[model samples]
Target chain A: MQLDVVVGFFLLGMVAQLLKAPIKMPKGLYESLTLFLLIAIGLKGGVALNSHASGDLLIQAAAIIGFGLVLPLIAFPILYKMGGLSRIDSASVAAHYGSVSVATFAVAMTVVEANGIEYEPYFPLFVALLEVPAIAVGLWLARDRNQELDLKKAAHEIFLNQGVLLLVGGLLIGWWAGARTDSLMPFFSSLFHGVLALFLLEMGRIASSQLGVLRNFGSFIASFGVLMPLVGAGLGALLAHALELSTGGVILLATLGSSASYIAVPAAMVVALPKANQSLSITASLAITFPFNVLVGIPLYSVLVGHWS
Target chain B: MKKRAFAFEMAVSFVLMALGLVLVQLGLPGYGLVVVAAILMGLSFVTRKWVAQTANVKVAAPKRGNH
Candidate 1:
């Protein structure tokens, strides 16, 4: 399978940052790019589900939820015991890994589409499903038992956070509009990769800046950051195959499973897990895992999955 | 466990995930994930126990509340 060309933008961003080249991604452009990708992805999934909903879809979604929950459980012990992080730090890191990354998923989608690989469009639905569960699991790990937990605060952060609200909202709107959206596809569907290219360029610059922090943390976070996604992607493949997803679906699921959340989870963690160092999670996710996924991991999963089946 | 040991453990975990996927493809669609999760957790518990016993050369606990 061929690597997506947009990945070049990520590398370019990193290079620009590394060279200390004067590059400013206009204020809030990153946010706008993120919003575009999120809605585009949600609309794609919503449009697919608008026609494809069935009992079987529910079963697949339930499986995706299980997939989400299981990832952090696997990650926490490693970070806590083996990596020797504090309990909250380990859980925070685990939650970051356990949750899915939209940018990574977007990369994977582009990878498959570039390869002419046909995946199920309902994947964005799975992306939405994969977002929150790990955050919930992370909150459970981070909360002090004696502390009076704010259920309302937690609910708002988890359910109505920027990522969830826009993705779910877009999904609902896409479903509501249905074929009426055909005209707008020129903007949403056609311009998606270009928008993603711009988004990744900014992400590249940002991720490059986070590297030193990950380095300071030492080898385990870096190593786990690289390897954990492989584990998640492997399980995604198995589960997708079990669900009897198409080959493209298997690739997409593996990509989704393998990614760590740099966007949604970090924001929610600030509100929910106050004691957990937000930067630690960000450094690990964005600095370590994000680049790896963007540069090497996406293609690696594709090749691995291709060889598997 | 040190970083090296943790890396080794992740390697084992990756292999276990593939093994589970193969099992699922063989016929047991529903149980493959459970099997993978079970064995991985079991591996974690066992390794941590080993790490505790060998506690001489451990990865230093991370400093917290510094974010």
Candidate 2:
């Protein structure tokens, strides 16, 4: 599997940033690319969902929700007690790990495709499903400090979030359109890599910029960024084994479990955990965990899936 | 001035949606791209509204402080 094309662009972005090169994507363009990727992914999944049995879909959805809910609970104690982070910081970081990274999931999908591994078509639905519950769990864990946690507001934020909305909407549209969605392949499928390359370049730039901030958080947080993913993957592997997921499905699950939310969860955290350190969560997710997952974790998880399945 | 900015933002969004429609009409393989284009368009409007709301808060803050 040639991962170089995607990884290379990522490296290019990071290198350019490190060199302080003036390369920059227009903010709107970057956001548009993200919109494209999320909708495309969701639509693809929805189209696939049309042919899949309802029972299997329900089972998978339940399993994924369970998987998502557990991740933050697993991370919080470790962060709060072991890492000695403050309550807000631990919960914030835990929430990040609990939710999924669309970018890392994209990379994992690319790898699976490159390797010609068969995966669940509704995996995108899993992506959408997994985004919410961990956030709910994370917020719940931080409930002590955040006395005024509004369930209504949090629900509105999580469910109505742009990323979630686009993904779910695309899924519904794709399911409704069925084979008629074939016409969309040229725009959504053909140009996927090119758009992904552009998106990743921007990510590399952002991640590199965040690197300077990592030093302030200390070795524990830095190590937690790497360590939490491994732990997530281990648990994911066990779940995949028990669920009897395919190699591709296992990889996807592991990736989902291992990857942290830089986009959705952080946005939620800003509103939900007002006192939480935004930089700590963002740095841990985007700067450390994201790069780690894309570059190393994906391949490692793939190997783990191979061993498990 | 705020109304004018909001209108301008909406116009840009409409144009983006139109562009997406054109991509679909051209018989692109991925009709889903239309949805992507539409999402971008919707996002433009949402962003504009968010910006407007934020600007309003910023403008109102000083007035409130003076009291």
Candidate 3:
């Protein structure tokens, strides 16, 4: 298959990650870069949807949401049993498989945008919604049957965690406050590309930093990371087509459904499912599968969307 | 299954997603989405770091006892 630019960026990011010490992006800048990417993608999607929003689109959103919830339910057990993780670890990992990664989805959106492909604007919103259920399910899985559940801790982790709140929160505020173009536009619009570029740069740094971990358990993690997303994409596409979504809706659904929640899921997992091996979850999401999805996954999904839709 | 907490998070996530959808419905343009997402994601990262630190400190406190 011919490699696309987004995939190239994904590779570049991975290369930067592998060479982290020499390519020094400050850790502090990482999140900021990711933020920029999401906002940029969101704005573009928002602009596109101005003419297109309808009842069918909402149905498609529901499909994406269903895909997000279902794919993890199917994939996590395989990952857990095959990867030799403890039950809690498996559940945490499984939870991540269930949630969508806003950053990766953002990157995919950037790719689709650069390619001039039309996709649903609500996809990111679906991505945000997708983050929660897997977490709830994962927590349920990880919770000790013998011990009384601590409602307070669960509440804090779910409600207060920055990732869950911010991406979803920002997207909602921007959507509801529609056409606040005079003042809010400049801040949201001008600064996003620079932020994403920087975020990718920092991602390079993070992937590289995680290299040591990869070499030790590279095979198992990489296999799962690559396979899981494909599993998600497959399920997403089937669901979209079954729902008779538009081509763009189908593509967006596939991407959202396939994408893993590296940021939101991992952060929440650290609190919600403490016994789970975070390093494994983080490495799988960020180091192994994330780059792979961006590079090969998006184009592959495009083709799948193209062929299936 | 803390009813209140679960409901709050689900509610918050639902609102965020809906907000994003509405933004796209309007003609505010692409950069607006990016900036908004960037700020939210950045804040999330900060909060994640804070939580991680607390989790680590809690983990380490008992280790100190062994020493």
Best DockQ among the predictions, by candidate number? 1
On DockQ, the stronger of 1 and 3 is 1
State residue A125's C-alpha deviation in candidate 2, in Å. 1.1
Q: Which stretches of candidate 2 lie over 4 Å from their true place?
A: B1-67
Query: Best candidate, TM-score-wise?
Result: 1
Better of 2 and 3 by DockQ: 3
lDDT (tens digit, per residue) of candidate 2 on A1-309? 234479788989999999999896776998999999999899999899887748866887898899999999999987887666788888989989999999999999998988888888888988999899988998888888528787788788888888889989999998889899999989999999999999999999999999877546644465567667877877887787677778898888888889999888887888888889999999989987888777767875675466446
Evaluated against the true structure, the overall lDDT of model 2 is 0.80
Q: Which segments of candidate 3 are over 4 A away from where they belong? A: A1-10, A17-21, A38-61, B1-67
i-RMS values of the candidates, in order? 9.7, 18.6, 16.5
Minimum summed lDDT over a 10-residue window in model 1 chain A is located at A214-223
Candidate 3, chain A: TM-score? Answer: 0.87
| TM-score, candidate 1, chain B alone | 0.43
RMSD of 1: 8.4
lDDT of 1 at A65: 97
- For all predicted structures, in order, the TM-scores are 0.83, 0.80, 0.73
Task: Provide a comma-separated list of chain B TM-scores, one per candidate.
Answer: 0.43, 0.58, 0.46
Using TM-score as the yardstick, the better of models 1 and 2 is: 1
lDDT of 2 by residue, B1-67 (tens): 3344334334434553564466456543223324433543464455556666878999999999998
